[model samples]
Target: MTASAEPTPDDVVSAAKALHALTAIPDHSPRWSNTAEPTQWTATHTIEHISDALLFYSGQVARRADAKLPVLRDGRDAPVSEHLDNVLSSAHVLAALLRDLAEERAFHPSGSADAPGWAGMAVTEILVHGTDAARALGVGLILPENVCARTVSRVFPWIDLTLARPPELLLAITGRFSIDGVHSDPDWWWQSAPLVEWDGLPRRRDVKPGWT
Candidate 1:
């Protein structure tokens, strides 16, 4: 998990828009189905997966902030443009919900999270999967570095930022492979819970709960 400043809805909103512009270019649009290296999912599949995740998270946080809501899972065969639309739409809704009540905890399999934790997860999905989609499309995903840095600090407090920057860490977060100078630990897992709750460990997913 990347850890920093609680990711604002604005940070994710901006990154999704940037990805939209990058993929909208004629040269990149045609490669939507191409393989995104280091991951088997196609560009379209990766984006669709991100959309599903954001929508799922939004529902969780919204429920925590107010009423009970069921999450929606859209079909994957939709056009690439519609997929991007869903990504942006989900980001907007999640961001808005988090704007005022970022501190509220929501249910998560990994751990319950407040607004910052949710927002950090949202941005990480947008930027990291954005990297996957962009790589498959033959373009680079450029978002706010400061925002990414803040995100890394907040969600991945266990990492020493000096070893690598947020960009590399984002890609390696999945522990698929190394990029630039960063590598993933298959044992590594996201710290979906609040940073203040971290125990200064790597949050290894391989470890069972209640294990000291």
Candidate 2:
């Protein structure tokens, strides 16, 4: 992954819009197929997960805007529907924050295990989770080249590539890879041992509970 291009506020907004549009698809279609926990999710549940992520991030942005250090409560195991609403609401908050502070420095509270800065983190989640939702719904949503390029670039620094995973696989773990055909099996793990010795490569690992 490259780390040169950084998305402008417009890029972030565009990505969010694309995600919302993709999630608008009807829930009962046969096209939707991927699921993090296949036995637990349907098309509706996938959208809900996206919504949940959006909500969580948006709240963080809001707290930041208020000059308060934002802390994300544990919602990893929350139901997909609850998380879906969160994702939607959070996307709106994130977009608003981008618009309000275009040049704000990136922030990652102490416990954030995901992306580091605000823009990078937002782009990562929107791009990756959006892809997950789209894949589950069997909808084809294309992220803007610039957004993906920027994300692919920035993602390298925060990740540990030694896990011996492909760029897409790493992105899938971080929730940035949005293209189709990526698997969501929770049991499959991509170990980072092989990629550890590669020069200049970021460290990454694939654990249980695939895309959610």
Q: Write the per-residue lDDT of candidate 2 for residues 69-162, one digit (tens) a residue.
A: 4344444665443554455556656767656654333233322222224555566556666666666666677666656555444444434333
TM-score of each: 0.82, 0.54
**Highest lDDT: which candidate?**
1
- Model 2 ranges with Cα > 4 A deviation: 1-4, 20-24, 28-40, 65-89, 99-116, 158-212
Candidate 2 vs. true structure, TM-score: 0.54
List where candidate 1 sits over 4 angstroms from the true fold: 1-4, 25-30, 65-70, 176-183, 206-212
- Point out the worst 10-residue segment of candidate 1 by lDDT: 203-212
lDDT of 1 by residue, 1-212 (tens): 33435677788787678676544645345687688666688877888878888888877787773433465565546667777888899889888888866456887556777777777778877887788778778786666777777777777666556666666666566663365544466555568777778888766665452111
> lDDT per model, in order?
0.71, 0.49
